[model samples]
Target: MNQERSTLPSIWSAAPPGGIDRSAFTGKKPNKIIPVPHEYRRQTLSRERDMLIHDVEQKTGCDLVPHWDQGKVTSFDIYGSGHGVEKATVYLNHWISNAHTKSIGASAWAKLPAYDPNKWYYAQVEELDNVYKQRFRGPVPSEGDADAPRHAAVVDWPEDIKNTSQEFVSPREVFGNKLERLDELRMQDKVYITLQQSNHDGHWYLEILGHDVVDVELAREHLTTMIQTVRADAAGVQDAHNTILDEREGMEVELQQCEPWWPNQADYVVPQLLSHAMMDKPGSFRQEGLHFKQHLSLQRSIKAALDDVRRRKGAYDFVVRLGCLALSSKTVSKGIIGRTVSKDSFSKQIHESVQLDVKKWLANNEIGCRILHRLMAVKGFLEPTKSGGYFGYTPETLKETRPIFRGTWVFKDPNSSVVATQTSYRHPGRPAPFQKPVEDAQAAPMSLFVIQIDWTDDEQGMYEKGTPTFYKLPPGATGPKKNMDISLLELGESRAWHFALESLIPVPRKTVSPVLVGFAERVRMKRNYDISSTESFAEWDTTLNIKKYLQTGRLDSIYSFGIEKTCYKVELTAMWYPSQQLPVWGLAVRHLEWASHLAELEDLPIGRQAMWLDTISSFLPDDGQSSSNIDEDSDDCGTRRLKVDDSDDESPRDGIRILTDKLMKLSEIVSSVTDCGGVQI
Candidate 1:
């Protein structure tokens, strides 16, 4: 076999540049091929792969086979033969028997086998060394004096280094005078010779035919040059071809040791030195023309993917932050400090802040960093106490307290940062301080607590003469061999409560519905979106447009106060109680009653603006007028006319009923929440 095609040596030292004529090397060759048997199979084809082949052949224009198995290939396979050929005989004859051993074949049969040049072939010339001997008989001369480095055209070294050692002999001495002498040693096509220095980096080491070489200048240069060429050739890049050919033929390695806790160590690195060095030449990494260009493209593809993820995360967080802001403070002041309010004014304030902050953040980072920037925008909204954003935790409860949620508000109080007024019902013995008791779990000495006139009704004389009756907790209990007496009020006094205006309100019970459960699950699966914050005005408003529709239904009247459609054009007149009070009152009821607190307090904690639902059913008028006068479904909205009556210098009976009805509605709403397991009146 020809040595060039035989054992496949590395770094072929061909006959000195022009030492032999080409006519002697060319000869008569066979046009037909005879498949060699049992010496080339590396591994058998998988059944699944064969099935895939059958399917592809039926669907596509061509048949396919596994080109390579592991690292070896079946070089003698004879496919695409005449129909008369025995399929079994052809398959068995071509099967490799011992991939590890060399096979003997006649030299006459050694001529270059016929093949489709368009396809690739693992061609090997048999007995290549013997053929070289027969064709070029004599001692092959060196291309230059012993002083010259082997194949000076392919390598360059410091003159001093080249002359310093005998290993740096010329290519002529290494191969010989006959062209066949060089041809005999040539290995498989496209072989590389890597040289390295061993001791004190002065000794040379060679891996004549293997995968890697030691770290040295010669080896580094050769591998680096080859890598550049392969990368360019494989990618079909052409501009830097000449530049790559001129590189030195030696390797240089800087030993990068992996060390513990060392900043400069190679550990955890992606190992790109070889790739980087190879691509250092200009135009070597480009995809001017080639197959699989997209596969090798790393920068643009990975960056775009990252940017997409960031944008999604950013948009989600932006919505969530908007919710918190929408539920915060009011932009416009109403008739009185605590009397009337333009519906959803406070919530609108929060929503504006969320939108503004997110917009600002997104402006700076643009597309790729969108997700991260949006998250930061949300943090900015709550971290700064613009309108007292609720991260979903109660303001004054341990369960509602979180490092991130605990916020501060500006207040005009000498003793504290913020101060709120409150009213409480107490027994005759308890002092005025009972309105703001400091003791925990200590109940006032009162059997029954009556609400103030403002909280009750004059029409029915309710609470004017006798205390309005409601359910009460009976004290005392027994367990095992002991007797216990635990009162509901005793437990209630210790719980956290929220002050809705000046009235002391109870918290609502937490009820879990399938919808709520699904919402909670969605919240949990996300990396952000805390459950407690979802109930806030900002979150609710930003999350959906339905909330604004809900608010419209609860308004009695919306007067266009500003110039036509200009700023401040919409002025809403509404009479509604605080929605945030429910959670405060609910938690209190649950803990005081000694019932299991099944809910997370953060989920119901209201910020400055409570989450609200404005339904038409909640705003029906109380006047005794006939319904035939107006279309009940004209706009599916509710409105109540506020009527004032003076008779004998006293308010009218109907007037009293209106106020009572308002209170009852509040009670009914509370009751509805309690049905979810909150509390009873």
Candidate 2:
């Protein structure tokens, strides 16, 4: 009952001086959280897992071990589209379809096919060995021999490999299904409530969007059937999207930081090397990450699906209030969040660079003609009967679509420094280079200016509606003031990271690399800043707590601390190459923002004050951690009690940072989860 039912006024505005009117209550009504039982939740996840797997296999024609390739091949590698590389080979002694028979000369041999577009046709290479070598010594048969003793005609496909897990269920297709359900949820309701979404759909379903739910139980008996059906019933799908966020820099969620210190050193040597290190790490996240904004927008849009009921809660603000404000007191354990790995981020970046080109090369290039034909076989378009390969859409459903927004970008040189040196473009008197036009000598030679928004993301993503303008051109695009003068190191290219860091990176960036920003710098905020930022001390304290929770996977990990006892280093390397930087800074900010929001709700009146109880009577730590307390009659249509945990360990997690050089501060600081066990991959 203490949960605030009244709507929080919209914080964004399209007009000047006075941004969106904050005084008027204009957002959607909040949802009521009705807690369900654990068994019910588990069963529902189980059932959905089974059904979805069957559905995907049926639609794709991958039902049996024989339907695919007559069992000739066991496992094959799939490259591109996030699939890494693997090797392959073909057995020539297999069944021949021709009727003629001819003997092969001693020099005759079989040639293996080369790489195909977007697909790895085989798994290994026997590379036709020296003609008579024992391993290559098979009864030599003619190409036209229809009855050559074939390699085992009934070869079995290994269902155990990662690529073949689709025989169990398709991850790509499941992601498609999750998106579809999200689309449905977005349309049905006018005003979406994080509390309601979490309770009804389960945190696994909402974790990608960053919502950590706290349940208020209604009744025990009603929960019996509710648990088995509610979660699966409302979500329409399970959130099994394990596609790793390809933006790892300093995103390991580790409890350490690394960088050279001392301000005197910032100006002297080649700063680009330091920037290169940052680039090798995670760069600005929220803005440029793959689909960061899409997940966020999906959550926000869930309220009305962009229909009649309007919501002014940009992704960041709502999470701050929801995680930081609404669910401040509790931890969400049933939640299914994502995993963030440095390798995934690094690989993603690497693949994206050439994945497209590789696909084209394998398709249009003359060398690619045969390779392209091989792809259609497994793709279900296997018609050696036709000339132009045509593997049409499987189980053709409605084409998936989401909202889009107009946006701009500036940074291009991955070598630019995140640290402010005497010669840096952002150093005091120097004009902000990112703010300049591409033609300006000060600007990045390959600077990007326009792009679209992925409205379904949730990594603190933001987007503007009007035609985007450039470098500090005043009378802001949607409001009276310009969007810059933000004190953090330039996102250089990622507005997504800036918005995400509006709540996450600084403390952690400073935590590892101390010399980046000054102590005094962290303390100041301009009166008219577009993004609502917290003081360094608040951010610092919150970040430290977040670090502990991530490592321990415990809700009790969050405890208040004194700013004086803490040490901070302003990480100025946010401008480092995004790949290297994302795992470090990007992930730190992401975790911090997510946990801080939930911790926000734990404390009332102010974030600084927090109360922790030793044990929760009602929850009872069923899985391993401590649980919540509940009273009798608590289930009398009153509210059920629920706590959301961090996302299950297998989910994908990524990060980004936008720290700038600044001096400052007294501060304190420090940060997988499983979704459902036996969850079909």
Candidate 3:
């Protein structure tokens, strides 16, 4: 296969200073592609990206830190995304230092409005390295030199230093071709950790690839002092937090006594030197057990190595710091394309941080949800519209006009039932696909969009869209009405529950009408199943609408042959249409077009996996079943009794009862969590 066709081509952004030439990604013959103008090389981002990056840094203290040292001739790419998730993260990199296999370089980033020190420092460090490489090392070869860190680039005595080395060499002899014969510099048996505190004070490990006896004594003292500094700071911060909590009760006592507390104060601890030099090689020790064992072992090795140096070379009595963590991961592999550290390794720190952030985000959202439930006055689902300006539609009646909608509002009441309190870019439910709309630059998010629904009346009263709200199926009419008489559906149409479909739920093949299923299967299994050409398409034009059955009141059935492995859990709201006297199967299926998050369902822990079950229990206002419970003309979704045989648990009501019991247990867990929140931890 041609290489270009075999792989996804890189997308090019806005054009650069030069007019467009041969596209870098286009698969022209090698003979035709090479020796082209340099302007045509390298991918770039749109101008908007540069502006956004600048705006983010200026408005929010966050910075984007990328990996350095692997300088290939490529343009900068500021934005990246896959699926729906953005790829802005902080990670660690394991690099080759001197002759050691791995040297750790941790990189981190913060989004705007959170000027994280680690992230800012990481970016600044990379920037300095980039400048030095561009100036001293010179522009990369047009085609690019992948074999990097030229012997000359490594000769910088300041950052690349053994300080004790007696050997000396000039950059000219290395890169300038001054030497008649070339020689590769090699480092000797030694290990060193260089902490870059600042540009002027930072230390380096080597002048070239050559190794030498390291100054273990100085290194040990530095390591011990830095660890002590970090540990002390952490302890101090914890102490301050404890002191603040202790005084909270004092405020109550003081209020009783009409007294005032003293001023609050605490020292801010600067972040540790995450950007440092440490061996990146895999830990020489491994035991087939949990991580705590490996963590303890790494600390032991550090301490043991320190003791060995002290015994032989009289280094400081440096104790290894346990319970401390640092980030380091390999970001590239042996391939032409860039490789990265295993996601698990690189994302460990970020994962912890994200979990904490997400928990806080969720907790706040829970509060928001409560406030919204009180404001909206209804508990059914409300999906955001595609437009950026937040709009929510809650169906009132089949008549489109009666549908309740919340729209624009301002500081004061805008005469609408729903009120908008605040407008912000960040929304709590933004993570969900239903609410994650294409962001509108012009729209400011409201603090709260009040539903202003007349829930009391809607719940108790019948839908007011059409008259004759009773079940008198027009005496002698074979059919209720014409197919398009949508308003012919009578009262109790609103007594519906939004059901979240489960993959594990048993769906009988009989749930779907045999005729429809047979036709679908036959059409799908045909030798040329899909119609491509206009001529071929004409042969089965009947297949187009796929909804011809809705007219005959025969559209009384639904089928679930199997779960769509790729799609998310299907959610359907079932209603009893008294005119047709059953759900319009096609109408219920129409809900599938609306976007919803599958990840949300998957994210629930297994113990709390019955979220849908809970929704079903709380959401159902009524399930219209007659005395006979016989569907003479079966049309409703639940026409027949469905059995769930879990250990011979055959009854549907029993299954629901069991699920409800579990829901109560989970509710208690939630209460416990809320109670724990008030107590300081």
Q: How accurate locally is residue 38 in candidate 3, as Cα lDDT from 0 to 100?
A: 26
Ranking by lDDT: 1, 3, 2
Question: Global lDDT of each model?
Answer: 0.22, 0.20, 0.21
Once model 2 is optimally superposed onto the true structure by TM-score, how far is the C-alpha of residue 335 displaced, in angstroms?
47
Give, for candidate 1, the lowest lDDT window spanning 10 residues.
317-326
Q: Write the per-residue lDDT of candidate 2 for residues 1-681, one digit (tens) a residue.
A: 334533433333111122122123122111110111111121112222233223323333222110012212211111111101100001111111110132222112222357684354232232223211221122324446653323211111122323222343222233353333222222221111121123564322221111111111111112222222322223332221112222333333211111232111212111010123444443333234335454433222221211110111121211100000000012221121232234434235323431100000001112122222222222221111111011111211111111121122221211121211112123467544221111312322231111111111122322222221222111112211111111111111111112121111011111111111111123222233322111111111223322322111000001111111111111101111111211111111111122323333222221011222211111112221113323454453313223222222122111111111001010001000112211010
Q: Per-candidate RMSD vs. true structure?
A: 39.7, 34.9, 33.6
Q: Which ten residues in a row have the lowest lDDT in candidate 3?
A: 485-494
Q: 1-681, model 1: which lDDT tens digit per residue?
A: 696676664344222112112233123121112222223334433432344334333333223332233433322112232221223222323233233343332211212347774443322343454343333233323346342223311232222222223344432332333323323222221123333344675543332322223312333444333333323223321110000111121122111222222111212211001112443332222212111332222112222222222211010110000000001113222222223222233224223431111100101111212222222233211121111121112222222222122111111111111112224334577564212222332322222111111111122212111111111111121101101111110011111111010111121112111111122222212234332322221121222212211121110111111111111111111111224211111111101101111111113221111111111111111232212123356463422221111112122223223322232222222223323321211
lDDT of 3 at 502: 15
**Which residue runs of candidate 3 sit more than 4 Å off their true CA positions?**
1-76, 79-586, 589-608, 612-648, 651-681
lDDT agreement of model 2 with the native: 0.20
TM-scores for all predictions: 0.12, 0.15, 0.15
